[model samples]
Target: MGSSLSTPGASNANDRPAVAATLPPAGCPMHRKLEDATANVSPPPSAETNIDPRNNIPSLSQNPAYGQTIALPLERMRSSIPRTLSDLSTASEHESASTCPMARGGPSRTTEETKDTWVYPSPQQFYNALVRKGWETPVQAIPVMVDIHNWMNEAVWQEVLRWERRYFNPKQSNLALEPEEIPEVSLARFQGRPQDLSPKARFHMLLGRIFPNVYSELPPFDRHDWMVRRDGWGAEEQDKLHRYVIDYYSGADDEDGNPVFHFDVRPAIDDLDSLTARLQEWARIKRETWLGEEQSSITKDAKINN
Candidate 1:
């Protein structure tokens, strides 16, 4: 409902280390290592780097519906500014594969787990990701950045859940009540083509420029194609690798002075069924939204006539 993952009760973004499903809290050797690094390092001044321009305009009260013209299959979720890592549980866990020490955040709920549900990365991993990308980030700010990164991933997965609703709960009846029906959709593994622009993204760029007012959103800060598996569906659909597109967009800071971010998440139209579902989902939402508006207009007209 909210535009960004930073919204109240939502988590921040990005992928990190993988560990066992249940992580231990405190007394973790890895946790201590991370703390030691933080204390020892007299890092550069912390600043919000790697930022993208966001719209200063106020966000809509509810999620915006992509009208009939936009045929792409996409669902969006917003996150409010990220909280500090300390605000999270101090829990620690087994050492991750990072050469550098790092702490563990929450466990992921994605359907696929190469080595159990991957835990969000610690400050160390966050730092590594930035440096690996050639961004000169301050070590002192890694903790906060990690929290934001990890929370963004959580937000992206939430959008995946909205798409899975069609697969898991085709009935579209009582979706709010049927939490168990929705499948856990998480990043099975990163496909690693960050440089390549997805088809959906290219279309967004072309269309956005053509109609600046209608599609004026900024280009995604990052794009990830997640390979997910659906084993329960029938033979044709079963075990098929469905690639999902996640477009991360950073928005203007919220009233709290924390950056607002949005993820445009949806499944690629790899197959006929998926393509149909994408259009169907958009039509469903558009119709529902338009119906409400129409009903309100009719009521107002009647009152005015009276």
Candidate 2:
């Protein structure tokens, strides 16, 4: 169910061009319309996938959907496994590490624009993670896979920022926030909850049954809960941690034969203030875009009559 962005064989170099046009504007959340529009282009299913918490590698697990069973002998698989850090190959010494992003600190390493940028795992560490997960991945593919893993993380962070901006820059929000207030937003941590359904899933399922055609998309291929810390409010709201949910969805293939994907990112309904802020943001956009256009059209007609 994972997109080429997360899957092993789906090369990022080949897939990105096809979906580049579908990407959202700077800091804006992905437009949900792509969910159905690209549904028919989904790539053929690969392995049943869930991300590794450490490096976010799209893990390959035993699934008949892959159509190929693990055939390597247990002894053969264990033979090449590095037992210690010293045994691991130095990524910098190899060519695979050249184009790939390193685990360097700061925003330069990731799509994040703040000091709290995400760090990509080193190629050696990424390989170690695959071995630990017992995946039958080829050594040559680690560079490509690691590239995709890091790219997906950036995509996830972008999704989170869409929600964070509402609170981080509340003055622009429709909510009644003080004009002087500026919140310092930082990522506290990331928690993978692949097995658990987010609270919103139940409500979506209920709605799907009522209107199957409207909400016919499958359950999220993967889910993540991210904790974001916000500070600099007033005494009443010192430092606060807001939880956000990211749902990964795969759609039909793109022109390059790579699967397209959508990341549904939003603040979890756990915080009443956040939920209210989200609704207000939606309302603000509706007024400024759809209703505002209608009003402008009416005014033009009246002026012409005069």
Candidate 3:
């Protein structure tokens, strides 16, 4: 009966299928069961199919973890960068060149160079000229003139202050007379008597009193003839005076033959009465305007109070 049970066809161990050499030991039944269960089942879809919680929640890279994310449009971004008058001018120049049939290929290098030549005068130079011309006042009064030129050069302003301290101030040493004592010489001397005194002498006496260093530094003043000539007088007498100073110094040759004539002072005193009057008028207007506006504001407040 035992021999029959052990036979291949009979109900015996030999009749069962042989376990593979690679199979786990029979002691690990749970592992064997798991392997058998999984052998037929497809693997759970890869982790890629499972949406990450981070993906559902906005990523810090896409949406910042802290602070508001501003969504500026292209137009708004372009507008945000502030433009200056110079930038606007450059853009206009480019636009003009692009639009004009004559400038079909855009501005040539030469054209660009020409455009570059249109530079405004230096403020320091303008202020220096004004100081030289005997406009003895603070810089605050002349915004239009200041706008035309730059601020006074530091060296020039220092020199101007020195002169102001020397002549205008009562306390400073080397001051010949009090500010009140220095006679208010009329502008008529230059306007009226162009031929009586030599240009050098007139400049020496007049400008010398104003800018001692400048008068002392100038060429013997006799070498300059056209500078004193008063053939073309006009309403812009002040302008003429400015031109005289500018032109005389324009080709100024120094003691060492290097160009040195760069002092301007007349524009400093230009339109003094007019400027004073205008400033006064501006103050009055501003005061009246403010008062009117204030009255309306106060009236509204009073009505609300009542």
C-alpha lDDT (0 to 100) for residue 61 of candidate 3: 14
Superposition TM-score, candidate 1 onto the true structure = 0.55
Among all windows of ten consecutive residues in candidate 2, which has the lowest summed lDDT? Answer: 297-306
Better of 2 and 3 by lDDT: 2
Better of 1 and 2 by TM-score: 1
Which prediction has the highest TM-score against the true structure?
A: 1
Find the candidate with the highest lDDT and give its number: 2
Off by over 4 Å in 1: 1-115, 168-186, 234-238, 293-306
C-alpha lDDT of all candidate models, in order: 0.39, 0.41, 0.23
TM-score computed on alpha carbons, candidate 2: 0.52
Q: What TM-score does model 3 achieve against the real structure? A: 0.17
lDDT of candidate 3 at residue 191, scale 0 to 100: 18
lDDT against true structure, model 2: 0.41
- Show the colliding residue pairs in model 3: 123-149, 123-150, 129-264, 129-265, 130-265, 132-265, 133-265, 133-266
Clash statistics: count for each candidate: 23, 4, 8
